[model samples]
Target: MPYHEMDALHYVGPGWAVDDGFAAKVAAIVSSPGWVFDSFGYPQVRELLWEHADTVVWLDYSRSVIMPRVLRRSLRRTLLREPVFGGNRETLAGWFRRDHPAWWAWSQHAARRAAIHRLVHDPRFAHLRVIRFGAPEEADTWLYDLIHR
Candidate 1:
């Protein structure tokens, strides 16, 4: 769902989806049937999502694949001045900032990969079905197969 729509539905401030009480709000939202939630692995909501989720799809793309994509996306958004979540646009200066998406993804790549690796192998998550794809092509194939099946 779009961030603006989610914010309106959940009564959250713009760009506050990861703030305090977000997990509880998300938990409540995901309790309903036919809901699909996505996140960038916020630890606060991970357990709740894991407990309630039927299937987990992990896009385990490597840094080599992810870094270029992130850079390209940031460039496109900045150049186009596209309005993202909550009517916020990515500025060219933001690309050089430490909090930029490209920088964040690059910095967190190893830790994120480690966490996902642990989650996939941990016996605690055995009850949850996990589909991990190392490449974009693999993810596309999986989705195609799922839709066709």
Candidate 2:
């Protein structure tokens, strides 16, 4: 399912933190076998999901690749006033804010990549199959292989 669909169902808004019950809700949903969960590095629920996950795919694209996509998406959302997760909409004014997706991507990209690198290397998560994609084409190829296989 899409992230927005999950957020809407769980009553969580798009932001740095998930809502009060978000983690618990996610934990419950992912606790069941054969469920796939996607998150933007939600540390609060990482361990919980990791415990049940068999595979973790990280889109470890470089800042140069990510920034352009993020900027384009954010600009489109802001310009079109697209409603995002949980009825939240991006505004042109919000684009200038510190919390904007573009700014967040620019500032946190490296740190986030480093953290994921650490996570994949961590002994505690060694049981999980981790796949890291450095580019969009790689991710596409992975998906194609996954589907064809």
Candidate 3:
């Protein structure tokens, strides 16, 4: 069963699948040798990625930074009818919908930052190199350094 507010399985792409309940397939993709997966949003999948990832690049900019990006993204998607994964398209209606998860997340920016802080300090992730970028220029510098290294 899929929520009407969300996209269905038909919108899946290569290396992307809807994991309604099955965890085994998810685990295999994350831990399988010589394989790299991306675009995980679910808490379970996120945890797996955090644990196995050798380096975590966190765009640690303030809400002042992220809010504008999200706004621009929503605007672009709405204007061009861009196809986000799972046949989802961003819309002003969705952005304003109180029932929508995006609205809730956008409003709870502080909570999200707090959670990320906890994740950074967690002993489980102590072995992970966390790159925190405070500004766009800093992020660009880190990327250049990473590529050259």
Candidate 4:
């Protein structure tokens, strides 16, 4: 499931916050035996989730490398009229919104990468295995190896 599924805005409209309710959900999932999530760096629940997770994967790609992918994805989602997180759909107008993933990705890429760099190095969470890929090919190779193994 997309990380947005845990967000209130995912169910509601165009606002976002990882509230106590969302934290509770994160706590539950993080305690489970086996699962994977893409939301590790969200500040509110990052500590709780990362503390328990065994492995973390970060795709530390450049904004130039990531933006086109984000935009293309948003375009595809809008054109397909696909229902995301709570039956909400992306739109051209929504693309202009600050919280839209495409916009957010472009706007926050640098800041987010820096934050992840700090978190990955933070000693409190050092017990967790961290795998970072700086290029698309590296990530693809890692995934291929994992799947083929």
All candidates' TM-scores?
0.82, 0.85, 0.73, 0.84
* Residue-by-residue lDDT tens digits, candidate 3, 1-149: 11121123223553335645434555655565544443323455567767866766676677777777767777788889887865566666776777344465577778767777898899988988877878999999877997999
Query: How well is each residue in 42-136 modelled by candidate 4, as lDDT tens digits?
Result: 67777887788778888889988989998888899999987666457888889879989987988898888888888789999889899989999
Judge candidate 4 at residue 22 and give its lDDT: 65
| Model 3: ten consecutive residues of lowest lDDT | 1-10
Strongest candidate by TM-score: 2
Could you give the candidate ranking by TM-score, starting with the highest?
A: 2, 4, 1, 3
**In candidate 2, what are the lDDT values of residues 1-149, reduced to their tens digit?**
42324445444565533478877777777756566656643677667776677788888888889889988998898888888776688788887888788998899888887877877788888899988888899999989998999
Q: Please list all clashing residue pairs in model 4, or write none if there are none.
A: none
**Between candidates 3 and 4, which one is better according to lDDT?**
4
The C-alpha lDDT values of all candidates are 0.73, 0.75, 0.63, 0.76
Q: Which candidate achieves the best lDDT against the true structure?
A: 4
Encode model 1's per-residue lDDT on 1-149: one tens digit a residue: 32313333333344424346666677786676745666544677677767766778888898999999988998899999876664567787787878788999999999988988887788877897998888999999988997999
lDDT of 2 at 11: 43
Model 4 vs. true fold: TM: 0.84
